[model samples]
Target: MDYFSQSIKQAIRTVPDWPKPGVTFRDITTVLQNKTAFRKLIDAFVHRYHDQHIDAIAAVDARGFIIGSALAYELNASLVLIRKKGKLPFDTLVEDYELEYGTASVELHKDALKPGDKVVLVDDLIATGGTMLAASRLIRRIGAEIVEVAAMIDLPDLGGSDKLRAEGLTVYTVCSFEGE
Candidate 1:
């Protein structure tokens, strides 16, 4: 990792066996709580996409909203929310993806993006590649082009990043945990 990535990675807190046995969660709340770290985190993203001509950020639900909102402001782009099914009130497009245990769906307002809009999909982390993939599909269904998929942390051992790449989507991450 580069120096900036190292700094951001250090700000993350890891919880062992979270929500299940043998599972580790890389939490970004610690980074969000630290003013300096949070600034650096946002700055890193701004520097990367400032010149990309991005029209909007299609962020996965919850945690992704935090990063995407700040990034959208910095990039002077719109923010589109991808939420859990039924969370959106407007007409929506839904995509279902498989989790380790079951299937879950994500939704985006049908009119969230215009055709040909350039978008970056943001998320807190990439573990299984399901959520981001579903969000990307949702964006495409609206005829928007996905510039890339961005995340703060990647658990490569789970093959999320690799799976995304195999689907022809560019994946960018500040840092990665190889073995979880």
Candidate 2:
């Protein structure tokens, strides 16, 4: 494994039965809490797309916000947040998606991007791949060209990257869990 990948695995803390029973939630709070880990994560993401002229970073809501905003600032670009339904105040475009346990709707501001703007998608993790797919749909609907999709961790058993791969999107991650 690469240094970044190793760092991610070392930093992440997995908790069983979090938010419910029999489900393991990959907690990134542990990673974020570390100054070195957080800095390395930002550096890894920055290095991955160093040659790509990203115009903006489109981040999924909640967890995505933390990483996305930082990356946007590093890239000197704007940050677009795709939030849970009806959370955006201005004109918005929305998409619905099915989750492993349920369903959800996400929305983005209508003017988040101009036609053909180069963009990147950011999230903390990819599991089941539903939320990322929904976020990509919202980004495209807003007329942006997705330059890349980035996540901190990938859970392979969920086949999240495969789903995005089938859709022809490049998926990059710092680390992958055992099931992956």
Candidate 3:
């Protein structure tokens, strides 16, 4: 791995059988705990996006907010949040998607984007791709164009990145873990 990749990998903590059996979860709290590592993580993203004509940063619910908010501040772009169903207070655009176990929904406010707006979707990680895909659809349904989907870590073995690419969406990640 490259130096940056190695650093990011070292910053993450791997937990075994989290929330289920045989699941190796890539926990990013360690990265957040380290000021230098967290800055490095945001700096990598900011460097790539600062020069781009990005109108907004839309992040998936929960962890996505952590990275997305910081990135929005760095890039001076508007921040939009995609949250679980009924989480938003105002009128929302909802998209239902299949999770590994069953169905779930996410919501984005109706006024989050304008037509033809260029947006970058942010998340902590991409696993099965369902959540990211749903976030993309929500952004698109509001008439914004997705420039790319950005994540801190990607589990290629899960096929999430490939699935997003198959739909012609660009996926960018700072580091990747090969297997579960």
Cα lDDT, all candidates: 0.93, 0.89, 0.93
lDDT of 1 by residue, 105-162 (tens): 9999999999999999999999989999999989999999999999999999999999
**Structural similarity to truth (TM-score) of each candidate:** 0.97, 0.95, 0.97
Off by over 4 Å in 2: none
Worst 10 residues of 2 by lDDT: 171-180
Residue 54 Cα positional deviation in candidate 3, in Å, after optimal superposition: 0.8
lDDT of 2 by residue, 1-180 (tens): 898779878999889997899889889999999999999998899888778798999999899999999899998889989899988899988899997678899999998899899999999998889989998998887778898889999887888889988888999888888652
For candidate 3, lDDT tens digit of each residue in 80-169? 999999999999999999976889999999999999999999999999899999899899888899999999999999999999999889
RMSD of 3: 1.0
Clashing pairs in 3: none
